[model samples]
Target: MTKIKICGIKTLNDALAAIDAGTDYLGFNFYSKGVRFIEKEVCAEITSVLKREHPKIKLVGVFVNSSVDEVKNILDTCSLDLAQLHGDETPEIFAQLVPHAFKAFRGVPTDITGYEHKDGPAFLVDAAVKGMYGGSGVTADWSAAAELAKKYPLLLAGGLTPENVADAVRQSQPLGRGRCLRS
Candidate 1:
């Protein structure tokens, strides 16, 4: 079955609502430059409550080009279960945080040789927007993502909505799907 991840959760109420709606994962953005950036303390408080009340729902910390240490620190402090590196982080970084962190590539990478490993980290395929990390609100290349999904456990992101999610799922067939629901 395809899993669901609600990204950019800034409030406890929103997080809880997403959980109630059957989201398997909640992504809290740590990218200070991004629009949905949430403070560590605030995310921590939200995460603490969520962990207590909804332990089964996984919490993901979204980072953009942050150092390995920074990601690790934030994940530990906020009680996050996973990390989504939405930048140009090296494979070595993923290696260090294996099983805890994964990579997000924009528009699908031509060469995914080093990134793929046996039951290792899953890759998130998002729309490629110049000078942007993510949250572009542009539809991703479904055809390309579908080709990649044939090999790896990809998480389809970018431009997913209630109207088009079914089509996206049908086209990509990813392990999961991520969308930012700010309401």
Candidate 2:
């Protein structure tokens, strides 16, 4: 079965809702400039409750152009299980967070060249919206993602909705789907 991850979780209510909906992972956006950005204290409070109530659910911290120290600090402070590097983070930075971190690409890459992690979701593919890191509401390149999926364990994000999810799955064949539920 394909795993489901609900990104941009800002409140305990949203987190619980995603868990109730059978989501496998919950993403907390830490990019301060992003619309869905959540404070570290708020995320910590939410994650703490989740760890006790829903240990099976994995927690991921989403960062964009943040320093390795910042990511590490947040991960430890927030009790996050993994990190999702969604900006132009270097391979060196990725290496430092190996096994605990995965990269999120704006679009389909020609190859997984420097992002060869042996654990977790591996990589996430999001829409390549100009000047935007994610949650662009634009559909990802499913055709291109299909080709990339053949090589990597991909998590497809970007314009996914209940209506088009089946088709997205059929076309991209990703290991899972990541979505930011907005209300």
Candidate 3:
């Protein structure tokens, strides 16, 4: 079965709703400038409840352009199970966060070189927006994503909703889908 992840969780209510809805993963946007940005304390509160109430839900912390220490600190403080790196970090930096890190790309790459990371970290392909990290409400390139999906186990984000999720899945054939909770 395809995995479903709900991203941009900001409150205990939203977190619980997603978990109750049978989501496999919950993403907390820690990017300071993101539209769905959640404070460290709030994330902790939500995670605390989820861990106690719904231990099966996995928590993923989203970061953009942050250092290794910054990501590590937040991951530990928030008790996150995985880190989604969505910035300009090199593969080497990704290596440092290996086994606990995944990369979110800005749409499909012009060149397919090195798209796959060795030994760790799956891929998340989102819409390519200038000066934006994620949650832009813009649709991603599904045709291109479809091709890449065959090559990599990716999470397709950007402009996915209940209405279009099936189509997105049909076109892209990603390993799973990633969503953001509005509330």
Candidate 4:
């Protein structure tokens, strides 16, 4: 079965709702500039409760260009399970969080030389909207992503919705789908 990640959760209610809906993963934005950015304290509150109530759900912290130490601090305090490096973090920076971190590449990455993240289960794939990191509602190239999926698991993102998600899943064959900002 394909796992689902409901990202950009800001409140306890939303978190619980997604959890109840059987989403395997949940993402909390830590990027201050992102629309879904949640305050550290607020995120802490939400995760603390979730940690006690639903320990099975994997919690991912979304970060962009933040220092590895900063990300570690938050993940430690919040007890998050994984770090989704949604920035230009070097392989060195990513290695610091090794065994618990995964890099995110915008659009169809042509060069994955230094990444070599075969250790981790999957990688996040999203549209490379210029000037926008993610949550752009711009669909990515599924054909390219499907090809990548042949190598490893993919966390398919970018412009996913209830209506088209099935098609996206069928085409990309991702290990999971990360979705947000649907209306």
TM-score of every candidate relative to the true structure: 0.95, 0.97, 0.92, 0.95
Q: What's the CA error at residue 117 for candidate 1, in Å?
A: 3.6
Candidate 3 global lDDT: 0.85
Q: Which stretches of candidate 1 lie above 4 Å from their native place?
A: 118-121
Per-residue lDDT value at 171 in model 2: 97
- Minimum summed lDDT over a 10-residue window in model 4 is located at 113-122
How accurate locally is residue 86 in candidate 2, as Cα lDDT from 0 to 100? 97
Which residue ranges in model 3 land beyond 4 Å of their true spot? 110-121
Screening candidate 3 with a backbone cut-off below 3 angstroms (N, C-alpha, C), the clashing residue pairs are 7-179
Q: Rank the candidates by lDDT, best first.
A: 2, 1, 4, 3
Residue 36 of model 4, lDDT score: 91
Clashing pairs in 2: none
| Backbone N/Cα/C clashes per model | 0, 0, 1, 0
Q: After superposition, how far is residue 183 of candidate 3 from its true place, in Å?
A: 5.5
How high is the CA lDDT of each candidate model?
0.89, 0.93, 0.85, 0.86
Q: Report the poorest 10 consecutive residues by lDDT, candidate 1.
A: 112-121
- Cα TM-score of candidate 4: 0.95
If the candidates were sorted by their TM-score against the true structure, best first, what order would they fall in?
A: 2, 1, 4, 3
The true-versus-predicted C-alpha distance at residue 110 of model 3, in Å, is 4.3
